[model samples]
Target: MSLQYVQGASLFTHINEVPKQYAYLTQNISTDVIIIGGGVTGSILGYYFSRQNIDCVLLEKSRIAFGSTSITTTLLQYELDSSLRDLEQYTPLENSLKAYKLGLKALDEIDAFINEQGNNCDYEKKDTLLYTSKKEEIAEVEEEYNLRKTHGFSAEFLTASSNPFSFDLKAGLYAMDGGAQLDPYKYTHQLLDVSSQKGLQVFENTEVVKVNYLDHGVEVETTYGYKVKGKIIIVATGYNTQLFTKRNFGVKTTTFNIATKPVTSFGGWPGRVLIRDNSSTYHYFRTTADNRILAGGEDISFVPGIFNEDAALEKYELLEARIKTMFPLIKDIEAEYKYCGAFASTQDNLGFLGKDPKNDKLWYCLGYGANGILFAILGGMMLSKLYLGTFDENLKLFKLDRFDG
Candidate 1:
């Protein structure tokens, strides 16, 4: 019945349809930290803090990982599809480089955690391909290639390959060391389990309705009329950020994805790395260990919470049509499920990470373009350090006030 509140179907949902730990909130409680969303970002924050012997509470309005986390194509690459050159323009070169380095570190930490926990989340290293559709773009790719090279980040510039898509390429970059793929939901749930095991409290079906900042702490009121107080409050609610910050911060983009039956024997897929072309409205894909080809990214936009059911169905039909058009090798592909969630994008297409502008104890981590998973991990590390008064020089570059004029 709780699944009815979930808008989309994902592989993670199929695996963990029922909650292994089901405890509803009935009374108010106090904690050192309260994480407002139970997606990848919030879960990671909870896990990290709990490991440090910090008392943390995680609240989800709906079910965990039922939101944008489930909708991800699950590519864990440090090389952003958004041009690294463009990223350097909005933020300092050092900050951009730090973000990239932090992304790789986060992916490595996530893989290590999965292995230690022994959670079968289909984690693997994959090479990410970023090719161009126009010949002129080759020079731009080269510039990025050299830029990354200067920083000691590994990226290979390729003009030709016997890859599946035979589209003419001006140039492309493949980062074999930085890219990865995994089941988004399985990873989120694993973090949840680990956090809980470390004494982190989690309340499902609990939604925060209002937040009041106190002189010494913050008070949060939930839809179920339960109130919680915490020394620091972190909002990781993604598109639902308006609930915490009254001012709207970014554009809400709509992206579609589809998964096919397992292609267990596809020779072209090696550990099922991520593949993407430099189309204006581009598509990126990867294969799951189960052999399903997961493709996504016909990026569009719609007003949040008002997305038309009919329009969403039509969008999915178009995605399925595109998947069938692009990869014809698999004959058993089908669009098993589809839904749309909003991706918060700032003017610079970078995340807004750090403490709230008006409140020092209130923190926010969002607007990560489309690649929120890595940012979530980085955010957890940064926020955890801030709360614990332990500082990492690498994370200092992502402080929230970085964007303030």
Candidate 2:
């Protein structure tokens, strides 16, 4: 039975009327690296490997970026889903800071790649506003602000009086130049397009059905009975790794989002910064290049089965109500598109990005947090180095065995 990963009408403004046709694997092939999944993570791995003259083959079960990548809100924030203070409970403060710094570096790397490729992906550097809706949470927000400032990050504390939004901010941290937004679907296709020219082979509708580990390497058999032999296999398939591993690496949830039609004015939105609250399941929002408000985050526990139309409509209604509440002045903000998809979150809010402890050649890049895209960027870089026999100290923070029983 096929699973529906995404549902409802999702707008594709960033993507043009490009051809959807791609080659299907029908013959056996060999490569230095094999990447499963054609989303942003796999595309990044393909880009880095192909640029370094490594023979990489990427196989996707469906069309490129047709999975979670298409429905992603694309709010790139250096802040983890777990706050820095909260993350300290599971790991060392120094390690948490290292992950935060790595997120910042990933933002820089993404900007550099866009500049180098000159792709029009609606990439924009924006500030992030990590605020609390309740007045009682002001102290916690202040703690986060002070910690970031002490670590040399450019953070400013804001109170209800100083906050620029229409609503009462109570307290917030203005993370300057620490976030970005982009079109993940376009970015993935563009990266694959360029990499294909540099000897990177990509095949859509090629689903890997079985794996045969060899003494020297590994062989992956596709659904079409085509074999792919590679020195290493990177599973960038997001939360769909049940076929390969039995471990529950992350907790799965279904999140909803809605995109509004382009508005005429900002209506006191304040620099159009990316905004997220301090709620257990926070609402995140940002403006598109065309001035549309894209907000999401009414997450519910994941239920395995077909899409529930009634549940989806309820989530969309809640999301729309949230938009109206947040920006009261904006009138007639009709939701042009609404979508819901599966999202995964880890216990420590850090991604799992390294080799499987039981298997030597099987690597994983499961980025399970709000900083997933940033973590994917870091994963591509680190995993490439690991494959080349280089050791990175940061890899220890995301090892699969970090939470061993």
Candidate 3:
């Protein structure tokens, strides 16, 4: 089983009001696909595969949506954690542009899901702002804005004298309709619930103790000693995968978040736009469905933060202070929920997807950065098609062995 990503009761769980439950694996099962992890990524995979009439089983070690999904800020932005100029040093500019476009595609895919399945996840499209409070960084932000605008992307460059936001901003790139916000915990359950109705067997508290990769298929033994046979196994177990592969995937960091009580007044924050300061610390903020301001991003290196209380509390205080300083117009900024969890990120600010380079029977849908949700959406659409004799060339962008030296 994976280690807990979150420590206390998260805001997402309390907002759920009535929680959904799944049955434990009481008997052995056989299916075409066995998804390991019932978080948002695995739930999305199940939703895609189940719709294809593929017999799939989703296994969660503990309660569904209570893992890393519950602790996420759920600020879905198409932009990566790094700027395109910085990302170009690792990959070509065209490739970075393709990633940007893929993010938009993923956003549209989520929109379709909400349109068809009905929006019970409090999903909303929001404009994303990545700005700089320092005068020295104005050129860097402007360059990024110019690149997007040159590539025909819908972006507007905001200056200190111009934007509508009351926060400190010398320069900012406003990505119009390229970002979103949602209740990730609710979204995971909703996807799994919908997928379960279409032959997707879901089991909670059913941990996989061992995985045996056979010549044609894979078999996993659960903690209850029940075996599940499947043609393929997809690993979406957040950041805990010591048993899956030997190669380290990404660098782990403990990120903090604080959610304030709902504010009835709009204040100077017009339209509740999503905002992120592109400083060294990479802080971000968004408005929740209930009008509460949710902000995060004092990132420190480590897989878990619960081991150190003093450090975590320090981060929470910093975030609380930072939010109040930035949006002084917003009233009653008391923190109703404060938490931190593990966040995995690559140097290129991208995630790993597609089949294992060494093992064809195993696949990875691990979205390891700020754009995890978008990457997983693309993974579900591409990987699902791959199982049905179709291959998406875009999968080449997120191959598992891209960083191998």
Best by TM-score: 3
Worst 10 residues of 3 by lDDT: 1-10
Global lDDT of each candidate: 0.73, 0.86, 0.88
Q: Which digits, one per residue and each the tens of the lDDT, describe model 2 over residues 207-297? A: 9999888889889999989999999899999988976799888888888999998888888688899999988898899988878899899
lDDT of 3: 0.88
Error of 1 at 163 (Å): 5.1
The model with the greatest lDDT is 3
Per-model TM-score on C-alpha atoms: 0.90, 0.97, 0.97
Least accurate stretch of 10 residues (summed lDDT) in model 2? 12-21
User: How many angstroms is residue 316 displaced in model 2 relative to the true structure, after the best TM-score fit?
Assistant: 1.2
Local error of candidate 3 at residue 142 (angstroms): 0.3
| Model 2 pairs whose backbones collide | none
Clashes in predicted model 3: 0
lDDT of 1 by residue, 38-66 (tens): 88878888888898889999988887887
Clashing pairs in model 3, backbone N/Cα/C closer than 3 A: none
